[model samples]
Target: MMPKITTNRRKWKADLMNRVQTVDDNDRPATDYTFKRVTYFKPLGVTAQEKALSVQEKAEVVKRINIVMDHTINTKDFGIRIGEQLYNIERIWTDDEKREMELSLSYVD
Candidate 1:
């Protein structure tokens, strides 16, 4: 059985509609983007009445978290930004981290 789709797109979105402005091979409207529904969930958390964590247990969790973060982050990285930008100001993060930056971007009216 085909699942029903809940659509909330522009008027020319679906295939079989006669007034749709443009049609593709599959009969759906030609679009620059695809849409999908996303879902979020909350997990059942630890119940307070079940048990109280000891100080040792709390420290263990912090230690495990740092180990995970150390493994996940890439030490060397580069990135790209697209914009009309200006230049020269600075900020600092950790003792070794620096953010030398500036921007006075403008757009054509």
Candidate 2:
């Protein structure tokens, strides 16, 4: 078995958000989501390239982060929020022992 995950390594905190749409009594459209606490690592900086006007241009940098936590079945249909920025779940991987999981997330508009 692998070594236990130490809490000291997890330095950042993030929230998992699920998008929910509803209608108020007035029939106005509303959209929002709830947040759940999760531990995440620091984001890694990355530059994005976009094709603009038939030319390859450097777009804004998009940071990607990894969230590591105990095994859980509800990883899908959720987005991660760090501070004022929000990141969409890209992928998920679990350890061989199935004791932990790591979620790959990227920034989204």
Per lDDT, the best of the predicted structures is: 2
* Residues 1-109, model 2: lDDT tens digits: 9999775455788777875667988999865666765666655533233113113322232445544555543535677778877766655556656345665555564
The TM-score of candidate 2 is: 0.53
TM-score of each: 0.13, 0.53
Which segments of candidate 1 are over 4 A away from where they belong? 1-39, 49-51, 59-109
Minimal lDDT window, size 10, model 1: 60-69
- Give the per-residue lDDT of model 1 (tens digit) for 1-109: 9999954222221111111135789988752222222212111222243223323233111100001111111211211112222111111112123211211111111
lDDT of each: 0.21, 0.57
